[model samples]
Target: MSAFWRDSLAGLCALLIGIGIARFGYTPLIPVLIQHHWLDAGDAAYLGATNLAGYVGGSLLAAWLSRLVPVARLTRIAMIITTISLAACMLPWGFLWFAPWRFLTGFTGGLLMVAAVPLMLSRAPPHLHGRSNGIVFTGVGIGVIASGTLVPALASEGPAAIWGGMALVAGLLTLLTWPRWTPQPGDASPGTRGTTRAFTRPVAILLVAYMLDSAAFVPHTVFWADFIARGLHRGIEAGGFYWIFFGVGAMCGPVLAGFVAERFGFYRSVTGGYGIKAAFVALPILSQHPVALAASAVVVGAMTPGISALASGRVAELVGFAAHRQVWGWLTGGFAVASAVAGYLMSYLFDSYGSYYMLFGIGTVGLCIAMLLSVFVRNPPAPAAQAA
Candidate 1:
C-alpha cells in the first residue's frame, strides 16, 4: 500500500479501537446493565459522566504530552491502555471498579482522538487533508456498529462475556495497527511544534461550534439506545437495531461531508451539517414511528462525526500545518470539557425527569447554536494563500 493509505488505515483502526470500542461501547451496555440489575439508571448516567470527565482529562493530556513525547508513541501507548481498560471491564468488580475503568477507557480514547488525526494527516498531501479527515473519522462509525450490534447479541452471554468480546475486538485491532504506530522519521516534521499563540476569529468561532456540537451529541451518543429500549417500549435488541442505522449513517457521513467541503469549503460544509443535525435531534421526540426514528438516527449519526471531520480540516486550513496538532488538541479539549459537563447535566435531568424529551430538546437548541456559530467561521487567509 502507499504510505498515505497505510497511515490512513492505521489511524482508522486506532479510532475504531480506542474511541469506538473503549469509549462508546459503554452506551449499548447501559441498558444491559439495567436489565441485569447490575446498575440503575442513575448509576449508568454517573458512569457516562465519569467517562466524559476522563475524556476531558485525556484531551488535555494529549496536548501537554505532545510537547514532551512523540505523538506516535503517545498514540501507541494510549491504544494499549485503552485495550487493557476495555478488558478490565470483564472483571467481577462492582460499580466502583467499573467507574474507574470506564474513566480510563475514556482517557485513552481522548488521547487517540487528539493524536490520531495528526498522525494520519501527516502522511497525506495538502489537498487531500479534507478527505483524509473524513476517512479517519469513519472508524468511529465502524466501532459504533460493533458495539451497538455485536454487544447486544452478546448480552445473552452476560456482561463478562460482552466486555471480554469487545476487548478481544480491540486487542485484534491493536495487533493489526501495532507495527505502524512507530513514527517514521518525517512523521513529526520540523516546525510542527504547535503554537501557544492567541486564537484568530475563525479559530475562536470554530472552538465554540465544536463545544456546542459536543454538548448537542450527548443525548444520542449516550442515551439513544436506551431510549429505544426503555422510552419507546422497544426491547434492548430493538434499540441496538436502531443503532445499526446510526452506524450506517455515520459510516457514510464523513465521506459526504468531505465531498461537500471539497466543493463548498469546509466551513460551509460543517455549518450545513449542524443545521441538518438540529432537525434530526428533534425527530424522535416528535414521533414514535420506527421509520422516522430510523431516519433521525441516520442523519444525526452522519452529522456527529461529519462535523468533527470538517471542523478539524477547517482548523488546519486556517492555522497551517505547523499548528495543526496544537489547534486540534485545543479544539478537542474544549469539546471534551463541554461533553463532560453536558453528560452530568443530562444525567441529572434524566434522573429527575425520567424522560428523554427534555434531553433531546436541549440537544436541539445546542445544535442550532452550533449551526449559527459555524456560519461565522471564515477562511482566515485568502483561498490561494491558505492553499499555498
Candidate 2:
C-alpha cells in the first residue's frame, strides 16, 4: 500500500528467489545428492569451482547485454532463466548432469545479481539504503538457513522430488513478482555521457577493492567448516553450528551496518569492519577454543556484508546514478571474474597445503590492503564549494 512497504517487499522478493537459486539451493541438496550416491566430494568441489567460473562468465554476458536490453526486462529474464536452471541440478543422475546445471545456475544467478543488487541500492532513498539492502540481502541467508533446516528433513525424499518442490516454489515467486517489479530510477537521473568524468576514479578504486574483498571472503565461506574440523578439532556438528551462526550474523549485518554508520562515519566504520573481520579470520590459528572460534565467525560474517553495503553506496554517491545498473554491472562483472578466480585459487591452495593457515593469511592481507585503499576515497565537495 505505502511506497516504502511496496518497494521493500518487491525488492526483498527479487533478492530472495534470485539469489536463492544462484547460491543457496545447491548446498542443502548436497546431502540428498550424497545420500543418492550422485556425487562424491571431489566432484562436488570441482562443480562448485565450475559454478563460480560460470558466474564470472555470466556477469560479463549481462554487462554486454545490458547495453542492448533494458535493465528491468533483462533482470526478469535472468531470474526466470535461473529458476529454470536451478531445477537442472535435479536432472543429472550423477555429476555429469549436475555440473552444467550448476554452471547454468551460476550464470543466471550472476546476471540477476548485478542487475538486482545495484538497482536496489540506487532506488531506495538515501536513509533507507543500508536497511533496505540488509532486508533484501537477508534473502540469501534465509535461503541458506532454510536449506540447512529443510534438506536434512527431506533427505529421505531424494533429489528429484526435492528439486520438483523447490522449482515450484521459485516459479510461484517469479509469477507473483512479474507485475510488481519496480521502475529503475535511471530514467530520472542524468544520462551517463556527461557523467564520464564522475565514474573514472571511484569506479577504478571500488573495482579493485571489491576484487580484494572477494578474494578475502572466499576462504571463510569455502573452508570455514574445514578450518574448524582440522584446526579446531571439531566434528561436523561444531562446523555446522559455526556456519549457521555466520549465516545468521550475515543476515543481521545490513541492519547493524546502517545503524552504526549513521552514528560513526561510513568510511571509518568500513575500515574498522574490514579490520575486525581480518582479526576474526585469523583467530582460529591463534587459538582453538570452540566458543572463541564461533564468536570470531559471527564477527567475520557480520562485518563483511556490511562492508559491501558501505562500498556500493559510496559508489552511487561518487559516481552518480545514470544508467547506474549498467555501470555497476560493468564494475560487478569485473569483480565477479576476480572472485571466481580467487575462489578457485583459494580452494587450490587449501588442497595443496592441506592446511588453512596460508589461506587465512592471504585473506588478512587483502582486507588490510582494502582498508589502506579507503584513504583515497573522499566525498566530492558541495556543489557551491566546487563552483567557488
Candidate 3:
C-alpha cells in the first residue's frame, strides 16, 4: 500500500487498539461472561465505570505530562500500554483480573487520542484540519462498530478465546504500524516550566460542553444492544445489527463535516451538527422503524464531525501552537470523565427500569446543551489581535 494508506491505516489502528477494551470488548464479552458465570451485572458495570475513571486520569496526565513528555512519546506510550494490557486479556478471566486491565486500557486509549488526533490533522496541508480530524474522529465510530461486530462473532466461543483473538489482532496491528507514525510539529513535550495554564474562557466552555456530550452519548453506546433487544423486543442479534447503522451514521458524521465546514463558517457548521444530532437522539423512540433508525443514524453521524472539528480547529486558532496540546488534553479529559459517569448511570437506569427511554432522554438533554455551548463559542477573534 502507499504511504497515504499506511498513514490512514496506522491512524485507524491507533483508535482500534485504543478503545478496543472500553468501547468494544466489554459489552459483547459481558454476555459471554454471564453465560460462563464469570461476571454479574454489577461486576461489569463497576468495571466499565472504573475504565472511565482510568481514562480521565490518563487524559489528565496527557494534558499536563505533555509539557514534559512530548505528544508523540505520550501516544507511543499509550500504544505500548494498550498493546500490553490487551495481551493481558488473554491471561485470565477473573472479575478482578479484567477490571484493572480494562481501566488501564482506557487510560492508555485516552493518551493515544490526545496525540493521534492532532498528529493526523497536522499531516494535512494547513486548511485541511476539518478533513484530517474528521477522518480520525470517524475512526471512533468505526472502532465502535468493530468492537460490537467482532465480539458477537466471537461470542459463540469461550470468553477467553474471544479476548485472546482480539488481543492478538490489536497487538500485531500496533507493532506493524509503529514506524509509520509521527507527531505533529510543536506537539512535542517541553520541560516542566512550559506546562503553564491555558484555561481561556473558550477552553473552559469547550471542556464543559465536551463533558456533557460524553455523559449523554455513553448511554446509547453502552446499552444500545440491550435496549433494542429487550426494550423493542428485537432479538439480540437483530439489535446488535441495528447498531451497525449507528456506526455507519457516525462514520459519515465527519465526512459530511468536512464538506459542511467548507461551505459554512466553522461555528455555524458545528451548530448545525449539534442541531441534527439532538434530533436524532430521540429518533428511535419517535420513529421506531428499522429504516428510520438507519436514516436517523446517518444524519446524526454526519453532523457530529463538524462540531468536533470546529471545536478542535477553534482551539488551535485560539491558543496557537504554544499550548494546543495542553488545551486539548484538558477538554478531552473532561469528556472522558463525563462519558464514564454517563455510561455508569445508563447501566444503572437499565438494570433499574429495564428501558432505554432514559438513555434517549439523556441524549436529548446533552445534544441541547451541546447546541447551546456552540452558540457561546464564536469565531476566535482574528489570530493577530487575539495573540496579544
Candidate 4:
C-alpha cells in the first residue's frame, strides 16, 4: 500500500486503542461494575472521573514529553501502557486499585490523542489531509461500536473477561501498528512555534466555546450507557443497543461535518452544530420514548467528534496555518481541563441526586451558551500584506 494509506491506517489503529478503547471503553462497563458489586454506583462514577483527570495530566505532558522522546516512541509507549492498564484491571483489586489503572489508561490515551494525528498528518500529502483525518478519527467511532457491542457480549463471561477482552484488543492493535511508528528525520525536534499574538479576541472566544463543548459532552461520554442501563431500568443489552446508534453517528460525524463546513464555512457549521447538539442533548429530558432516545444518542454522538472537527478548522481559519498548531494546542488543553472538571462535578452531582436528567439539562445549557459564544466570533481582518 502507499505511504498515505499505510500511515492513515496506523493512525486509525492508534486512536482506536487510545481514545476509542482506552478512553471510552469504560462507559459500557460502568453498569457492569455496579451490577457485579465491584463498585457501588457513586464510586463507579468517581472512577470514571479519575480517568478524565489522568487525561488532563497526559494532555499537559504529551508535548513536553515528545520534546524529550521521539513522538513515535512516546506514542508507542503510551499505547503499551494503555494495554497494560486494561489488563491490570482484570485483577478486581477494588476501586482504589482500579482507579490508578484507569487513570493510567486515560493518560496514555491523552498522549496518543495528542501525538498520533499530527504524526500521520505530517506524512500525508496536503491533498489527502482531509480524507486521512477522517480515516484516523473513524477509529474512535469503531472503538465505541466495539465497546457497545463487544463489551456486552464479553460481560456475559464476567467483568474480568470484559477487561481482558479489551486489553487483548488493545494489545493486538499495538502489535499490528508497532512497525508504523518508525521515526523519520527531525523526529526529535520541537515543531513550529506560534507567537502569543495568535491569541486574538476571536481566537479566545473560539477557545471558550470549544471548552464549553468539552463540558457539555461529559454526560453522554461518561454516563450515557449507565443512564440507559441503570437510570432507565433497561438492561445492559438494551443500553448497548442504543450505544450502537451513538457509535454509528460518531462514525459518520466527521465526514458529515466536513461536508457541511465545505459548503457553509467552518464558522457557520460550528454554530449550527452547537445549536443542533443543544436540542438533541435536551431530548432525554423531554421524552424517554425509544425513538427520541435513539435520535438523541445518534445526534449527540455525531456532534461529539463533529464539533471537534469544526472547531479545529475554525481555529485554522482564524489564525492561519503558521499559528494553527499552537492555538490548537491551547484549544485542546482547555478542552482536557474542562472535561476533567465537568466529569468530576457531574459525577458528584449524580452521586448526590441520582438523576441523569439534571446532568443532561446542564449539558444542554452549556451547549446553548457555546452556540451563542460561537455566533459572536467574527472573522479576523485580512492581513495588510494580503490586502495590498
lDDT: which candidate is best? 4
Please give, for residues 1-388, the per-residue lDDT of candidate 4 as tens digits.
9988889999989888988888888999999988888999999889989998998888777778888888988888988899999999998779999999999988888787777677887788889888887888888888999888887898778889999999999999889988889898744333555556678888889988888989998999899999899889998988888888888888889888888999999889999999999999999999999999999999988998888888888887887867766677678788888999999999999989988999999999999999999999866647511422
Better candidate number, 2 or 4, judged by TM-score? 4
Tell me the tens digit of each residue's lDDT in model 2 across 226-260.
Answer: 45644466644455566666767667776788777
If scored against the real structure, what TM-score would every candidate get? 0.94, 0.83, 0.86, 0.97
Candidate 1 lDDT, 166-211, residue by residue in tens: 8889888888888878877777622334354526777888898889
Residue 327, model 4: Cα distance from true site in angstroms: 1.3
CA RMSD for every model? 2.1, 3.7, 3.3, 1.7
Query: In model 2, where do residues sit more than 4 Å from their true spots?
Result: 25-37, 118-130, 156-168, 182-196, 225-239, 321-327, 378-388
Which residue ranges in model 3 land beyond 4 Å of their true spot?
1-5, 20-22, 64-74, 90-92, 123-130, 181-187, 190-198, 296-306, 320-322, 382-388
Which residue pairs does candidate 1 place in steric collision? none
Error of 4 at 305 (Å): 0.8
- The 10 consecutive residues of candidate 3 with the worst lDDT sum are 186-195
Model 1 misplaced stretches (Cα beyond 4 Å):
189-198, 379-388
- By summed lDDT, the worst window of 10 consecutive residues in model 1 runs over 189-198
Candidate 4: the clashing residue pairs are none
- lDDT of model 2 at position 265: 65
Q: Which parts of model 4 are misplaced by more than 4 Å?
A: 186-192, 384-388
Query: How high a TM-score does candidate 1 get?
Result: 0.94
